[model samples]
Target: MTRKRVLCISYQFPPFAGTGVFRVLNFVEHLPDRGWDPVVLSVLPGHYERGTALDDGLCARVNGSARVHRTKCFQGIDAMLSLRGTFRGNATPASAGQGETAGTAPAGKGFWQGVKDAVTLAYRIPDKQVGWLPYALAEGVRICRHEKPELIYASGGPWTSFLIGLALKAHFHLPLVIDFRDPWMNNPYDELNVGFRRRVNRFLERWCLRRADAVIANTEPLRTLLADTAGSGNKCHTITNGYNETEYVGLKARASGTVPLVVTHVGNLYGKRTPDSFLQALTRLIDTGRLGVHEVAVRFIGHVDEARINNLIGSHPVSAMVTCVGVVPKNQALKMLFQSDIALLIQPDTRLQIPAKLFEYIRSQKPILAVCGEGATQELIEAHGLGVVADADDPEGMEGAILDVFRQARSAEGHVKKDYMAFEAGALTTQLAGVFDGVFQSSPQMKNG
Candidate 1:
């Protein structure tokens, strides 16, 4: 069978390790099995912003499976930030895997910082990754002309990929599929975009949604939200972020809990997703003599937003109990996740979004202690009986949840078994391929082309 070609436009790709990379990475790997050839278009490694972690293992996994074209980006912001860091006598993009306490103390939220943020918000129209548009657009056009791809699949957080896809669709008259891993305008982190910038984002979101032939959201709630905006509810689908079961082929959960109960969070903590409440709960547990100071160990295995996370952890009494492992390779991180007694998730204020790490946690079968309010994350955890959930604001509840997990681990019953075949990457990719089939068959653009 002749596989239909899809030009996958994603700003986040392998080597640049983060939650953002996993969705598209999985799709790229599995799309071929479903009779779709994925041709990925991404930014070069140098174009990646500061604090991005590289995973060579992941990069190698993609090699030869599909053709990947990486283009250079205009690094205006990177240059400016690097220059600023040089002047400030700090390292350029703080080195990863510096062990626990690997961050500098957060600078004061002064007038200058406020001004800088305002200026950045005003200029970085779609996002900071807007710098990649021109280069990606050129490369996309070249690919369309040479490779003659039948469809365009654009995944976003760096929503620039959508714009690139839109431009290509306009030029080539091909079917376009846009995937939203996170909300653009309705994003809970309003601090990043507000006033005029926020309004501009809403307009762009509607503009792209109207143009795309199919829209995919990683969460069902997000699918509903996008469906309302797109005004074509039927076209919007929920093909969620799922685990790569093949990655867990030989991995096994620990037979028993560690000496000091390890509560591991495998992803980055930034924005409003801080460990403030979790740390507070830990402190309370120690104060009340529920959990000893050295009895429970909390590990953050990925990136930690220097200012927000470190400053908070630095002053906290539970700092000694917490370890930030910075960013490790994908395999190492998964090993850490499986070996831990409990997996900690600090998801607050985001209702529609579910972090990619959640699926992996499900695969690990380790008890998840999610400090999330009422949303998709909470609902999934509760529905599956995965573990415990405590709202971030409820310190007492979080403390209790942690204590409960500790006890369960101590009793050697922390591992959970749940039916998650629906959350597997290959299954999810089959759904994506089904979407592709419908779009290709129904698309007037493809017919005309």
Candidate 2:
């Protein structure tokens, strides 16, 4: 089989830990096994989120799996601010929902944000990172010439990643498979203004989506959104974020074969899904002795809203039982999930959000307590019979779900692991590779094919 060369332009690559990295990570990590060569074009380590560690092992795998081109650049402002307090990775989708999350972009976010908003009348900036465009374009073109990949896969956060792919598609006529890890203009979370700029962003978003041979979205809802933005009858694919059982390697148990029902929430805790109710409910479980002594511990094992955490713990019941482990390494995270009898998947509402952590929760082989969005998440969890779900916004509802998982755990008919390998990392990558394969075959110019 001939190896297909792929140029992957990812705005925030590894060393930039967050949900956004998952897009290109699978493609780059699995390309070699699938007979594709990936040339990754990305910014320097610590470019946006400083000290956000990359998985060296994963990088080694990517290094062996494909070629990487690092176009190192940084903002002096970000660097200077580093001295005062670490600028969290919460800016772009890389860490969206993690920090002060979507905190009102200050009146003076920067020149481009203001100009784009004014010009388009968009309430928010138009895919900010407008500053990164020129550099990514120049570097992407250079990589395109050198590697001359059969197809370019640009997954975004800086949004410029897709722009780079579009540039290559226009200049080299290379087949481009643009991945929308997050939506371009009409993403559910996007705060859109009422007028001209919103229309302008809609135009650019449509142009990018329509031009792509195929597009990949993280959720079915997002796929629907992309399809609507791309117009009727355009093809959009949903290849979700997942856990790799094979990559899961080995996991450590958080509790030593004991009965205290442990509820684990991993990954970014954005504003969309508040954990206050979840924590409060679990505290009630302990208070009423509904949860056996030491039987209920709620571990929030990732970056979260620290200030809110303090306030919630102060007012809510289970202050002693709730522990916030701020952003540990992935291995540690996996271990937390492994030992967990219940995986807590929280979202703000049954509204327009589906946290990527839901898939990982299912794949963790633990019972899931799904909080929020009955959209796609409820569909999959129910189909798989994975776990119980609660509404985070409803304390009683969330508490009820927690106790249900606990009851199931102690019952003789303890929940057995379902076939979650379907959501494994490599399988999902293969799903994406199929997208690339289709585009490659559609392009007539590849001489060898």
All-Cα superposition RMSD per candidate: 7.4, 7.9
Q: What is the TM-score of each predicted model, taking all chains together?
A: 0.84, 0.81
Instruction: For candidate 2, write residues 1-449 as lDDT tens digits.
Output: 88888888887777566677765776687777787888888876745544456665556556577667776554533434453234333356544444443556643347545544454332133454444667778888888777778888888655657777787799998888877666566455655534665676667678888888888887787788888777743568888777656557766544435766777899877756678777677667767877654667778887788789788668555666678888887777887788887788876544434566777777666777777657767777777787787766667787788778777666643457578778788898889888888878878685556
> Which stretches of model 2 miss by more than 4 angstroms?
49-58, 72-125, 188-197, 232-234, 252-257, 283-293, 305-310, 313-317, 350-353, 412-414, 446-449
Count steric clashes of candidate 2.
Answer: 8
In model 1, the runs with Cα more than 4 Å from the true position are: 79-119, 257-260, 286-295, 303-326, 407-413, 445-449
lDDT of 1 by residue, 136-177 (tens): 999999999999998999999888889999999999989999
Look at candidate 2 and tell me the lDDT of residue 425.
Answer: 80
Residue 424 of model 2 has an lDDT of: 81
Error of 2 at 278 (Å): 1.6
Cα displacement (angstroms), candidate 1, residue 7, comes to 0.9
